[model samples]
Target: MSEIGITCTGAAVVNAIFNATGRRVRDLPITLHKLL
Candidate 1:
């Protein structure tokens, strides 16, 4: 269902952010401060 897509998409975004910045964000509503 849509849930699966949402989960996968979020995971991909998180992974990308981690790869680019070497940070792991384990929360929702990722904000700029969370990366710093």
Candidate 2:
């Protein structure tokens, strides 16, 4: 889903992804995060 884009629902977006998968975004890679 992130590959497409984040939804307008903020945390709900992460929650949806987490529900579908099994991982939580504890942290992002520094370089990738800094770019965003």
Candidate 3:
């Protein structure tokens, strides 16, 4: 059997935001202000 690690919701959101806005965030806790 194979085991997988936990997924990071913050990373996913940051990636999505980066892809859409071309902004790379290197901070923790992705907030609405960061995205804007």
Output the number of the lDDT-best candidate. 1
Candidate 2 per-residue lDDT over residues 5-31, each given as its tens digit:
554455665566568666565443324
Clashes of 3: 0
Question: What is the C-alpha lDDT profile of model 3 across 1-36, one tens digit per residue?
Answer: 122333566678778889988988889777778767
What's the C-alpha lDDT at position 27 in model 1?
A: 92
The list of candidate 1 runs beyond 4 A from truth reads 1-3
Q: Estimate each model's TM-score.
A: 0.79, 0.43, 0.55
Candidate 1 deviation (Cα RMSD): 1.2
Model 3, CA-based lDDT? 0.75
The residue pairs in collision within model 1 are: none
- In the predicted model 3, the residue pairs found to clash are none
